[model samples]
Target: MDFYLVFTIFIFAGALIGSGLSFYVEYTKLEALESYFSENKVVCDNKRFWGRNTHIDRFYRMLLISQLLAMPKTHIKRGDVTEAELAAIPLSLKRWALWPINFGFIWFASIIIWNVWYR
Candidate 1:
């Protein structure tokens, strides 16, 4: 295979692998969070449940602040879950889903530049 083609394929394959791994990590976290909420009987607003942060928040923060984030504002307002409740969450591995995506763009840009500069 041509060198450029080989490199492009490798880049795309890496992106695919990274994306798959990130998705699995995120799915696991979501399941864990949902179970935790159901057990604790915490109710979150629909907006909170479906927000951008809910979908794409980093895994490290997710592990730490998930309990706080899962709680509704009413609970906080009613003094059910305190700001100090926010302090006790454990630390864990950070899920990074964007590495492949960022690299994909870099690869694309490099390919374009290579073509232009070489031709």
Candidate 2:
């Protein structure tokens, strides 16, 4: 196969895996995260804004948690997440919430780069 075709296939597989992991986190761990952050007004308000669509709500929640894990200081300064609350979260949960989103972001950027470079 051509190198571009092979690389594109790899990117597609990575994106699929990232999406699946994202879905898994949303289904299994999202509720716990929601409860933990229930008192955070910013998170609650965003959740409420996406309340009309459960899928979007869950996706947003995943993204929020990922952001919270990736940049605790920023969210802390913004009052979106507290340090104590962030410390209380399990490391495994944090990893689960973080990696897939990171992978998705990388995968997206790769696709954009590939298109721009190869087109």
Candidate 3:
């Protein structure tokens, strides 16, 4: 049961990190989209390649997911994260802006309780 609890925490943390990484990747996409929109301004064309994924990008994205999934459990728990109390540091860096720690809390608790109590 304790193993399940720990495993739940591990999976939840992996999910949180995965989500944060994906969100950051998507933010980069949004920045590119904004740049394109600003430069083109609805220029009339027939090539509608919206939301299309390039081969290399998809490959790397899959690689990232696989790499994260394969990462050792100890590394994440011991990973060095930036949680400094400085005036110049941005809130996004000082805090887990993309996927905060509470996600791990709720995710693990829900999974553990559901499995232990209901299963």
Candidate topping TM-score: 2
| Cα lDDT computed for each candidate against the true fold | 0.50, 0.82, 0.42
Cα-based TM-score, every candidate: 0.38, 0.86, 0.29
Off by over 4 Å in 1: 31-91, 95-119
How many residue pairs clash per model? 0, 0, 0
Residue-by-residue lDDT tens digits, candidate 1, 1-119: 77777766766676677667656656665544434344232334332554454546444434333435544376678754555443333344212323334455676786686677557
Q: In model 2, what are the clashing residue pairs, if there are any?
A: none
lDDT of 3 by residue, 1-118 (tens): 6866777667767776766765564444433322322322221121133334564443343333223223425324544111121223344432332233345556667777767764
- lDDT tens digits by residue: candidate 2, 1-119: 78888888888888788878888888898888778787888778878877764777789867777788899998888877889888888888778778787788799899898898696
Using TM-score as the yardstick, the better of models 2 and 3 is 2
Instruction: Single out the weakest 10-residue window by summed lDDT for candidate 3.
Output: 39-48
After superposing candidate 2, which stretches have Cα over 4 Å from the reference?
Answer: none
Return whichever of 1 and 3 wins on TM-score: 1
Candidates in descending lDDT order: 2, 1, 3
